[model samples]
Target: MPTEKQPVNFIESALETLLIEQNALKILSTQIDDRFSQACEIILQCKGRVVVTGMGKSGHIGRKIAATFASTGTPSFFMHPGEAGHGDLGMLVRGDVLIAISNSGKSDEIMMLMPLVKHLGVPLITMSADDSGPMPKNADVALTLGHLQEACPLGLAPTSSTTATLALGDALAIALLEARGFTADDFARSHPAGALGKRLLLHVEHIMHQAEELPKVFPDTPLNEVLYEITDKRLGMTTVVDHENTLLGIFTDGDLRRLLDKEQQFNVHTPVSAVMTKNPSTIKAGMRAVEALQSLRDKKINQFVVVDDENKVIGVISMHDLISAGV
Candidate 1:
């Protein structure tokens, strides 16, 4: 009689699963060739959205692939194959491209909708294990994942195949992203609620302290009066400008500390220009907040004078403001 099987080491089993899936991905990478490029070209030429569809575990991967494509500059949405048969097929239009994902290239629901897809004249792109199936045969471009052994110990789960499919989807999305010259600002536009959006979209002008909020004084202003301006404005620094508002220099709390530490004599009525830091680093109001933050860090300073075309001090911006504003 056959004996009952003994339990295997849990870590060894896990490692084995990962190794199998890794090997599958290695094989899948080598399979990418002209067919992948053709699929990308079809998508590039599509005037409408790239509609993705799949069934079972493939459906889950399809949803993520569609989302990645959408966020990365490709206009895309996931359409369930089962739902497509029930009038959702109307989502597919003449200018659209349909990408169907099926490990075997023979999902019944996706197969059932092919007639309507063809009638609508939408380009069909199929991803599967091989190019022999009906779905691949009918596709405008067929992308294949090399034959993969399942990572499952019993060789039954969708482990390695799903990993390969997801990787392929990411490859396609990133290729299109580069081909379209997509920028961080473009991605930020699609994700305004995230940290990157705040960095790229927020401008120095939007957050800078301006007008009465700016602590500024003329070259002849008394040192005691300049301190009051810095205190009242709460910006920790004051711009020393000429009568015409052209920036001459700046004085900060740090400057006050260093000056007092070195000098033995007291002079409250000293002209700020005598001690101010001339030609301090400045930024334009139109600069992105992220760049402003970087400037602050690079210069080892707390703030910047926001200048215009003629180096006139229009506003004051600080690292504190950027951090508080989520930049």
Candidate 2:
């Protein structure tokens, strides 16, 4: 006798779906091999952009993949497969690499554009599950997906399959990033508006006090004059410099407290150099502000002199400046 169908248990179905998808990813990882390396090499050799294209669900994933690649150092963008046939294919050029995503490897829109892509001499890297499909057969490098059953109970929607495709795209992008020796600075340059960008790209010069705004005095300048500079500039410190503006040392509010604690007097006639801390922390204008902040914390100091290569103080930065600059 034929068994009766069980009622759908939504919670159990959801958990099962998650399990299947995660398992599918594990299976997909095992399939990565020489073909993956070949694809990365082709992308590395590409002087032009990585043009990612696909249809439907694959297209959505392709957009994210394109964004990931662009941010991580590879120049890439998503192109709609349907749009490719409608004159958009003109955007692709020689030296470009095409990353085509189609779960079955036989998406009509992607397949139709393959001929033009090949004619343009663009290296094709295909991501798909169907080995028998013509798309993988013709690829310069084919990233094959492990054949896995869909997480959908009815085996209809692309559940595990799309997850596997997305994983493969991430794998390719990150591999290429490592191959290019992509760095945090490179990533920050591409994402300047983000917090990490500000931290890495905003250097000491951008936030430091410059020119007349810098609280400064010569070594022989009276302690009273140094106090006026620190008070007038409101930076709570002054750079002690030579007549040629070379950084000799620094004087801070903390130094004032230590002096007062010792009951030191004869304030007005005291030479600034007599009490100034010599060889104080200094940073170059070109160093990132976040690094400057780390230096302050490391040395237990609140401010740093921004110097030139010749070690002359051009500017000064406080912990307040780095905090204000979002470093």
lDDT of 2 by residue, 149-214 (tens): 899879889989999998888988888788888988888889888687898789888899999899
- Candidate 2 stretches with Cα past 4 Å from truth are 1-19, 149-155, 264-266
> TM-score, each model?
0.94, 0.86
lDDT, candidate 1, 210-249, per-residue tens: 9889888999999999999989999899999998899999
- Which candidate's lDDT is highest? 1
- Pairs with backbone N, CA or C atoms under 3 Å apart (clashes), candidate 1: none
TM-score for candidate 2, residues paired by index: 0.86
Alpha-carbon lDDT, every model: 0.94, 0.89
Winning candidate number (TM-score): 1
